[model samples]
Target: MVVESSPTMVTRSAGSCEWTLVAEDAPVLFPDENLAPKLLLERFSHDELKSGSHRVVFKLQTGNGCYYFKHYKISDWKSRLQNWVRSSRARIEWDHTWKLIELGFDTCLPVAIGEKRKGPVVRDSYLITREIPDSVQLDQFVEKVLPALPERTRRQLRFELARQLGIVTAQLHLKGVQHRDYHAGNVLVSWDETSLKLKLWLIDLHQVSFGSKLKTKQCLRNLALLNSYFSNRGNASDRRRFFRSYWQTFQTKKNGRPRGFQEYKSTLLTIEEFCDQKMWKEFARADQKWERGNRRLVILEGESEQNACRGVSELDRDFLKAVSQNPQNTFGLPLLNKSVSVTKRVTLKGEQGILSGYLTVCDKHSKPKFSARTAWDIGHAFIRRRLSTPRPLLFVEAKEQQWLVTEAIPNSMPLTDYAQSSQAHHLNFQSRRLLTRQLAAQLAWRDRCGFQDNHPTLFNILIQPDSDTFFFLGLGYLEQLNTPVSEKKIIRTLAAWTSGSLPLSGITRTDRLRFLKRYLLEKEGDWKRYWNRIDSKVHSVHSN
Candidate 1:
């Protein structure tokens, strides 16, 4: 079953550097064995497909057909030493591609490989493979193409795709191939329009290990990595279907018997545990993106020694410099609020074109340092939990004051304002109920993430009229809890939102009950008990 390609190797030297090229002898592409290396090395017309830190992928087109060229450059001593010890990345991928092909697994066809070395140290390497026509990355296909199809057709395609992925993954594990970076982006999905037949191919083979049986840990880790993308994009039922298919296929291959309900349940739980660990690691990585001196972020010192500003790399330095010098004077449009901090709406030009942001300046007596830092931390926390909030952009610290800049959410108004607007009257009963449910769900999710808002008034929340999306404001009032919020605290938050000087409009008793039901859906408590406590707290606050 293993058909090996007869590849011809050619070595060329220029000054003190050596170049080695090995190419498969395919008559259609490489008619001349020696010339194939020169052609690929010298004059192949290419368009860049993707570029990363150390690797650049190009799509090469010739008389034969389309091919992908993945070039890997070793810039650091660590990478050079690794390559010297275990050979180049191209060589590893070349071997792995052939093995996968021989095993009858769908993968890219490795055509040629080249390495540039000087005195046993590889400086650069490249791998060339025949491209799969009309194929897109699995993640892209799901996000872009699937939604455009008919509802019934999309469901059928998704089911088939999940089933096929499970089958292929199980076969790979049974054959002793473990893909370390087994995410959706590394997999390619292609489909026929006429018959709606789908095909999947695994690519990016360098990190994969061969001839090593997968242990439980290895299996769970790989599945978790794959699930990370789907966990956000697909629902729970989709994931359950995928896991069931995988379990059935793996069991059939290993023991020729189907797994029972308890066994499947146990396996699914283990997989979920691994997925949670993966998510935590991912959250840590996201947090690191905002660290000082990171490539994505920059810090700039102002002319005055006491003044300094930090912002995302894309922000224009001149804008940040102006804000660093005097933030209160930079934005003259005052925002309506009762806080002691000076808040204003500002529009600035940056590398990303025009940016509109809210600028808050806190003086020394108001603890500007703490205010700026807390706002920054809370903004990122909302992002980590996938909750909607204003994106924190820049922070300026000075001897007398500090400034924090956050992106302005477009087409949105404060929740209280939205409730009083004509838009509230336009909504039907069902729409109002849906909006209340969504708002309550967001609050519940925030609570589950161990965050509590000191002031849970409608004035601190924003709602977009068109999409009904909720965005939290007043980041300075947000706090992280060391433990779960107590029942008393939960009731107090509900009472604060309801019994403020300005009562929330358009919400009836029925709507309040709907909100409570949704908020308590995940909490471990009797709904009526929570409702009774909340009602008593609201009445007590009103009486006070």
Candidate 2:
């Protein structure tokens, strides 16, 4: 395959997931890695086919932006994955997803099929499809907007997004497609402030199930994951709002009366009603399990008597400890993915094309909590904590790197996906704040270290709700700079961050950070105001 351009602007949504685009083609798609994926490259490049069992994305660029050809391999029976043996069942699964995409019901459509010259569409089939540009995953929206908005505003945004999930999933289910794994990672949201409504787009349909006979209960159960994911984050308020909005969105007038989400609204309603008391009981139960086993509630506070894990060094052990401490409160039993060893010492979840997984914390100390394998899971928690308050970043010394035991972000999200949602409207405000303190922090860190921030990820910036708080979970990355982020740089950039005052000099790693830093700054200030008001309110809630 002759290469013309390499893919530049290589990024993931602000959400916690990463993608493996036919990145081999990235170099040929862009002369420099400065711009976001260009649609020009996606349209022009003709990639040479590579033989192997891999989940890959071939990004093509056009005039304004880029799109991608997501390639997923159909699990082959005789292939290395065959040892686990689902036989023809998995192949049937790929076909099912493809069939639905072709149905125009909307999904990541398949661009190519994986098959041997002399074989049937075997289990190990490869399906390719064009990437949806300028769209973001749900979590990214929260990351960008939460830190900048007031808690009230953040809750509103979450409810609206959750409402979207309810209505959209209900639509998908009504249409007969069950996203077996309807977790946050699998959903994408789109929006433009100029546009009236926020939109939801679904992706990663390989796990979807649809046949002549649809499983309503199982499908509805899958849809219930939105409730589970949100509830665990201590967003009971969001659960109620989501439930109400979901019910309203799906309510239909039948025989001259409105029916509340009949297809799955009942289940959604039941789950929503029990969301509080039931969740408390479960967390309490998980706590009891942890307490009996001697553990603690690290991320979330719960009444469950379970003991969390204890006596852990901030390494791989911390992850297990956190899991033991929290046990499994929401989302039921955690999923185990096929592991892949990256180096002799580490493996990157190694689950073929699976993007989302169970996030288990370790039994490490209270501060600088950690996991032996990776800190990706903490990234989400960091955003959650930061959204609610100014949580200190507890850094743990590991083998060679330091992992941060972060607070759960209030209405947090990933930058990668945030770029694609209606949440961006609120980010306009947060971006102003991001410019000042937060972005300044990076520049200050750089000045202190006397080095430059290499490959600053705009994807790293996070925002809180009511659009007030801000944080960068990639705290350790800045330490590598020749200098540490300085107060001067941060202060100077404050205006630029919020106003988009700087010329669109083009988004660089450092500049992008500065751009997002502006949003973080504004968010931080708002949060300060909120705390002051809350603190001044009658001494305390009890006093009032």
Candidate 3:
């Protein structure tokens, strides 16, 4: 493939910024009289499509068509020095766009690029490209569009997408081009519904490097980065098809035949390991964000120098303070439950109409900070794991008292109440079995993740009106184990669920057996051994 030169290249100055316009025909780019690179740069601040810490992307409309405008801001001195010595990121992306075009890969069409410099350092840069019509991000396509298609059509589309992605990636590596930020979001997909024909384009080329052969480790790292999104959204067979396509496409006559079965398996495992590490690091980063106040959360000072952490967009400070001071008397709301802690139903009028929540005030031990922080951290951990739990709204910690507020899950009831309610009798056998299996599967997943609740009882679990969905409550007793849950702990959990002290209603012996079967689906131990041990423990508990 030969690179084509633009017929016209022009440079213009707007304030301190110098804009470079490259086009096959400059007159066709800005058909409107008022549209220019200077005006477009001015409009970027107000017409944002997406904004990040260092980048702002917006869409510009001209008589010709719509184009994407991306502005990159240099924050650190290191980047400024690098840009001063070398090419700016916008220039790199502009150059890479032509390189990709020459390599016969579909990519965004570059329109114009600009950079602003101070002394010898580049402070800001911009890149503009013509928008790809009827295109969506690969992740959005898989999440939103695929599910809407028929089963057969959806399967076919998925296969084609996986195959094309593999081919494109292989071609890039074969051309000695490596994309550092290779992920689903950077790939754009467009398809015809009638013929099911798909076209893919690579975007965000600022992180790309050209003319460097990819090593084995680099290949695996790139594949793992792409696989991170699909690991959650795609199934095993989908991933297998992808790897098979990649292996077939990546092979060359000089490199011999395609990989062997052992090689493929080993590659898959390595990629999975890399993906897991990436995901864990992301989770840890999110935890750090919560600890040091992010956009969603804020840390504030409470009465008497106490500490209060609240959701920025969810609850107000006044409401949080009122609830923390005297939850039982605040707002004259009805008391929901009382034992060791006081629970009050709270309602507040907000921008989104009525916001309902539950405020629980508990007496703290000597280490109030540790206790309060533990509950807050555990609640966030459950949310991070995508478990169903009432969202934590606020946490206030004082010397002797701790207040926690949680958003109320609509149409939810405690599992204990639901089990004894008339709704339980109305559920058919299949629905009841599904509910049992769901509960068991949740417990199994939690145990597999090394999380254990000290008292795993039905009372602490909330069942939605749908019955199949369950939400965990009372996260204060939750503990994250360093090792896998032991057989003894498993038996204890089972005993807690079926003990005579709780006396759960409507659950039969068959339901318990079914739950055990589903829970042991991925376990290595003998099912009979676990069943027998759980049975023994339950029997002993009931007898006592």
Candidate 4:
């Protein structure tokens, strides 16, 4: 997917340094005459690299076997790499992590540091690190071996992997390292189909943080993300097994929260005495259900103290237990006793950098009366463009906190680099028209969906896999709904793209959903209408 730039994002890096746009889709060719560290590998070597994600990993095969060399981008947003000798907490976290790295942790350890670009000790610091060999990222492993693994191995691996991840993450929190992006991809594992080994390797370490006291809330949210990943792969029973270890390992640990909630009394946040006041939101006359947006749920043990679902009653448990015992269904998810789906105790991700599976729409638990229903409706329409343009409908379902989870699109490289960009760069004749048509299709969609009604200031388009595609995201701000004049601004943007054809302004959520219900579901505004579509999309995706 080739994403278009926002007027703001055209020349930027997440680390907040200026980026040099490639005039052509060729590899970067850093000069041979340049210094050894900067010119360690040819600029062309970067064609294999995805921009602004992993540390610069250069595979230079010297006469002595194969080795992967890494250098941190000097321009990272944190801008702390300029001084390695002057230790900040991030560096301390890095240093402390190295000190505490136990054996069997097959992570990329820092081999050395390239302290300067050409000058000494002032800027352009790089960490030279090794690669995790004979191992694959969990996502890659799933793509490659998941289908091939036997049912038993997959089942067992799910629970065991969750247990391992819980233990690892809990241990990290205990050590007071709050890894901002502690999702599945950051944690690497090596499995032989007999026994699996787990290793927690921090990736994209620019956002990683260190503090004397860990924020239990933040850590739990991070852990919830882990739960989402494993749950998607395994089943409910597997997730429960994972939580058993998590509660056992981390719950009783001392000094986990540095300044108690009492310390934050002055802040907007307040520790609540009542459970419902702190936890679940009552909406539509009830709390919400786990949506298809986040495909899986994480069961955090010892979470009873957190004012979430403690455990279901013995009768509910026995019924669920019997369902798991049934040979037809492996995971012991609560059954729909009636026609309606049962409300599930699930957790989702929120932070922007990492993939928070089916992001939960955020709100203030302290609000007098909260309803994410409007947020969900707005988000679903908005996130649609993202899922459509970058790829086809990869929509995540809506859940607690108004989360929308979708299955990942398969086999995509960043559109700016690699073969996709190569195919797109310097297009001759026929290709240009085709791409124009595709963009036209997207514009038609936005036009059909009516971008003008959106709150422009709150507008965000989250592009995926580094492409020109920008899917409109973030719709919590509702005041942007148009009057007669502002609606024209959006219409003009759509009109210009489509050569003056007027797309429906999509005046209301009801209207947008009417289109969605008809186009996707072949009906209007019903949950089953959508679920049937998803079941069809992932028909082959059954539990082992």
- The residue-by-residue lDDT of candidate 2 on 1-544, one tens digit each, is 1122223323322122222234443444333542232333343654543434565455555443444444445444455455244433324434665576455444543332323222322323333444565567766766564444555565455666767666665556555666666767677766554333466667766577664323545544654555445543323355555556545544542321123334455665555565444434444454345434332223322225534223222224444344444433321334322231111111111113312222233233322322422332223222232222223322222322222334445466554344445664344444544434444544332333332223244455665534534455444332222233443343333322322322233322344444343334323345344334433431443344
Order the candidates by TM-score, highest first — what do you get? 1, 3, 2, 4
Off by over 4 Å in 2: 1-54, 62-65, 71-94, 97-104, 117-124, 145-160, 211-220, 232-241, 248-269, 273-544
**What TM-score does prediction 1 earn?**
0.71
- Quantify how close model 3 is to the true structure by its C-alpha RMSD in Å: 6.2
Which 10-residue window of candidate 3 scores lowest in summed lDDT?
Answer: 253-262
Give one digit per residue, the lDDT tens place, for model 4 in 264-336: 3331133222222322221211212333223223222232232122111211333223322331132223332
- Taking the tens digit of each residue's C-alpha lDDT, what string does model 3 give over 410-509? 7998887887788886877767766786678778767765677775776788888643578888777778775557767887887787663246566777
The lDDT for every candidate, in the order shown, is: 0.73, 0.42, 0.71, 0.39
Q: How close is candidate 2 to the true structure, as a TM-score?
A: 0.42
lDDT of 1 by residue, 330-392 (tens): 665454233356667877768879788888777666643246766777787687666789888
Evaluate model 4: give its TM-score.
Answer: 0.40
RMSD of each: 6.2, 18.2, 6.2, 23.8
Off by over 4 Å in 4: 1-35, 42-47, 52-55, 62-65, 73-97, 100-106, 117-121, 196-200, 211-215, 224-234, 251-544
Question: How far does residue 252 in candidate 2 sit from its true spot (Å)?
Answer: 3.2
Clashing pairs in 3: none
